[model samples]
Target: MITTVRDYLAAHRRAKDAFPGALLLVVSVFASMAGPSGWHGPRAAPVLWTAAACAPLVWRSRAPVLVTVAVASVEVVHLASAPGQPLVPGASLIALYTLASRLPRRRAWVIGLVVTVALTVALAASRSDEVFAAGTLASFDLLVLSVALGDLTRSRRAHLAALSKRAEQAERTRDDEAARRVTAERVRIARDLHDVVAHHITLVNAQAGVAQHLVRTDAEAAYQALGQLKDNSRAALDELRATVGLLRQDDDVSEPRTPAPTLADLDDLAASFVHTGLPVQVTITGALRPAYPSIELAAYRITQEALTNTAKHAGPGATARVHLDYGDTALRVEITDTGNGVRAADMAATDGHGLIGMRERAAAFGGTLTAGPGRGGGFRVVAELPLPQDPGDAR
Candidate 1:
């Protein structure tokens, strides 16, 4: 029941307006019963003056400056007519407080100073100067105190508003950053899909042409080409499914993701290129260490792209060698082919998108990649990826 009443008092505008004025009126009526000795005037006049002073507080918040001026004018008239009388200052105090809380600091302070001086002068003008001297000081103090309290309230409100605005801006920044990252990841996924399909389909197309040409003249050779086509097709499908599954939503519980290809699959990858008529030799030095999934996938994809480019651009019967060196702090991958290096025209034909994708992937894992002509009259691709410290052994 108390909660309900408090809520009603807060929500009801009329109740807020009436409550202070009603209390002041009751106090004024009671103080009037103390007689001329107690109030320094006839009981009826002081009561009427007090009522007049307290009545205007109803609209204090709505027209604070106007209410304050009106209440001050009433107090001056009351002091002039009934000097040294008991005055109810509630309405004027409410008005000044409301004005200070609503207006900007400089303007509110200026107005408060003017009102304080005016109240001091009016209280000092009484015939009994000795009695009203202390009242004058007291009135000035109350005026300043009211304005100070209002300014404090205003400052707190402004502080809260600023904090709320900063929080909203921070939230928006976080959302924008999240959206940008999501867009980058989608583009990365698209590039992977393109590389997977392009490399496999190019080999398939070339093998199919060979198979068709050799079907009558060389039956066994044609069958082998057809078998390679089947294997390439299956591998392409599996990689596609695995890559696409990564795009599934969290709640999509139907299909599970297959593990992505890593450095461990480099041997099988180079062997597959050899089946397509490109001989690739794999050489590894130093002990292998486990790496993060992203780093492993990046290494595999970079190697795949390099070998695919070799098969497509390098002439037939050209030998390619993949060298892996696991250093103390980094992993190095180098793919060199003894064929004509990538010509400017050839790089321009694909707009160098493959190389760009590889660079982006390498940079994503804080790695570096370079591709150009080899020192020994061929093409070479090299990447160095940093190795992170083991979490289990961290101090």
Candidate 2:
């Protein structure tokens, strides 16, 4: 409750503006009684000086320089009128401190020094006997203490402002990073969808056309083509489900039922290609160790994209080979086709999004991918992905 009240008053502009004036008024009342003649006595000159000194304090915080001048002029007049007597200290102290806090450091320091020196000279000229007295020393001490206090307040406010600025900058950086990641993830999902749909749908279209043509003349062949069509459709649906699973929120309980494709699914992948009239030979070298989920998925997608490219460009009577070699430090994948259909010109002219997506996927796992015409005749794709040293790091 107390903290709430303090915060409310701190934000209230009128309350803040009134505080300095009220404090100065109270101080002036006290200083008036300290004169040679008490407040109860008829001392019109001291009362007048006190009023003049404190009156300018109403604008002290708002116009510190103007207030300082007004107060200092009144103090000098009081000193000149009543020699060897000090005017009220509250008005000069308030004005000097307020000026120091509001102004720049260099200017504040200069102002504080000038004010202190001017007051000391005026007081000293009034009484040579009491120039070096304890009262004079106390007066100087008060002026120094006020400037120091104001400088301290200024430093603290500047530090807080700096901290607030850094915090805001950090927040903006975090927001930008999050937006970039979201954009990258959206692009990844679109690529995955394209790979899955393009491969299966192409096979489906071809098989559907074959079944339609052979249904009247060759029933058995048409039935076989129809079976392949159904298989291709199922595969497309399964892949779509798997890829779509990635889009679910973390709290989503109902994710896609189908599991993500991995190296283990390579045989199924090869079988699908065989049914599509392309003979694919998959060779695995070295002991297959458990790999990171992302690496395994990347390897699967790279192979799928390579085979899709082969199906699209390798032409008839072409044979394709997929080699997976697990080295001590990395996993190497190479896919080659022995079809002259994919000419050097075709590979050179290729600037398709599929190749770009494949390269991005490989690069995500600290891997590298190279694709071009094979040494003898067809197309080739080679990818190498670095492996974690510890088996436990596979996740």
Candidate 3:
């Protein structure tokens, strides 16, 4: 019984249908009043008629036009029979406003105009003093105002919802852009670290071979190579520290830094590789134009890595040539080693991209790179990187 009552009440609330329900209750009370005390009526069956008239109010919002017609018709009869009574036209007013607010501009206007005219006409014919007068026109104006208010409230709600959705989409777009930038930066650091460290590692490998061979034959050469080993080890560590430290900065807890190596340090690079017992030929063919530091750094790394690869895969009998040709539009690098040819299957092991990290360095500067067996039996790597506008440009 409790559940059934709750459900009935819930359904009633949804329709409120209760507007008509309460009106029915009031009409019943009025009918009882008319019968008991100072009542006089030849048209006796009183309150039931009023209650029946307002029954349609329960579905006013559901069928506004039908509800309006029924209430207006009953009110008309009640006015003709009795001169005075509290005939609440609440149901008609509610229906008229609902139709006007919900329907489109032209439809709402047509419906509202027809209903208003009908109500006025019905009121003029009624014998009741309660018939619509000039004051009723004021009530009609208020019906239109209520309709406009509901429409305005709906429009504002829609506008706010759209703005909220747009803000959420913008935040998602910002997050995606941040993720892309982070990925690009990591690729750049990987390229830089590979270039800077690979060359020094190659030097260590080549010198280790020389010193090992000479330590049993020539004592003087052995002593010199052992010293060179220490220098090479320290140099590699210093370069790694500088490049890595540049990438890792915590302003809250960092010491002052010194300058890092750049293209100007290429002379020292060429000399160190030569000390490793491999003959390297250097050639610069550009018109002496400066490039972006990142681009130049890219160039330095490419050359260094290529030489390192040549020293690793090619035997000591191989001769490596380094070329830096600067064109009007771009800078070019070519490292050719005249050594035994590498098999296609051994590529993953003996190729320049393997240990020297050529492919990664080339990608960092938006450059094109190619590495393969030379025309005869050796190996070659070529890269083309864009140049900066001015000859004095750097960084």
- Per-residue lDDT of candidate 1, residues 1-395 (tens digit): 98987798799876776577777777777776765456543367666776787677777777778888988889888878877665546667777888889899999999988987887777777546642567667877888899999898899999999999999999999999999999998989988997898778867877888799899999999999999999899989888988888888889875655578888888888878877778889999987777777787888888888888888888877889999998887889898999887763476476567788888889988899998888987788899987767733311
Residue range with the least summed lDDT across 10 consecutive positions in model 2? 35-44
Backbone steric clashes in candidate 2, count: 0
Ranked candidates (lDDT, high to low): 2, 1, 3
List, residue by residue over 269-356, the lDDT tens digit for candidate 3: 7788788866788888969677887777777777787677777677768888888888988888888888776643475654434433
The best candidate in terms of lDDT: 2
Each candidate: what lDDT? 0.81, 0.82, 0.69
**TM-score per model over all chains:** 0.82, 0.87, 0.67
Which candidate's TM-score is highest? 2
lDDT value, residue 169 of candidate 1: 100
**Ten contiguous residues with the weakest lDDT in model 1:** 386-395
Off by over 4 Å in 2: 1-18, 30-44, 58-63, 84-86, 126-129, 250-253, 341-351
Per-residue lDDT tens digits of candidate 2, residues 30-125? 665664554554345666677778777767778888888888878877787788775546678878888888888888888888888777667766
RMSD of each: 4.2, 3.2, 7.8
